[model samples]
Target: MSHITETLNQRGNRYGEFNRHAEITQNIKKAMQDSPNWATLKPWHREGLEMIAHKIGRILNGDPNYDDSWHDIAGYAQLVEQIVRPPAPPVPPAVPMQNPMRGAL
Candidate 1:
């Protein structure tokens, strides 16, 4: 076999598990997109979720003990969370109401 062919075969072999997990991940993503909240997500948030979902597939597909895969999911989520929605207007504190009975007593 040619060197190029050998390398390609190895790469394909590596992807065998990935291919199965990826199809499952795609279905997961589709379900997420179907939810009403999907429209509210920023593109960055959605992308992060997609990447995290892929990691989840890896974890669930006979590799639940893999630490880095879990970390990768957290890392992706953190990246999106770091720049999540714009700041909300600061809420004003309520003024204490003076009771009329206080002075009348």
Candidate 2:
């Protein structure tokens, strides 16, 4: 087997546990669905990302308990990408300008 394939398999095995965690998956979905608007979603996403960052900082500072930060980070990143997708904008109708020189000096 190639090095890349081995690394991928290892990561897949490690991260696959998160998929099997019903509570985590449900909570992620609930948090995502509870946000009413993009304004609210942005803050929630930022908070999750910040949490992951904090976890990383702790691990870097020698906190072994934060080793599972990758799972949280991946979850949050996936939520942001998957659930926070905005709806398509409504197309505005084109209107002909009555005053062609409206902005002329």
Best by lDDT: 1
Residue 16 accuracy (lDDT) in model 1: 40
lDDT of model 1 at residue 43?
92
Q: What is the lDDT of residue 73 in candidate 1?
A: 86
Model 1 ranges off by over 4 Å: 1-16, 85-105
TM-score (all chains, Cα) for each model: 0.63, 0.34
Candidate 2 lDDT over residue span 1-105, tens digit each = 999988866754544432444344455555645666535556767666555554444344333454466676678777777767787799999988699788899
Against the reference, the lDDT scores of all candidates come to 0.79, 0.58
The lowest-lDDT stretch of 10 consecutive residues in candidate 2 is: 55-64
C-alpha lDDT of residue 2 in model 2: 100
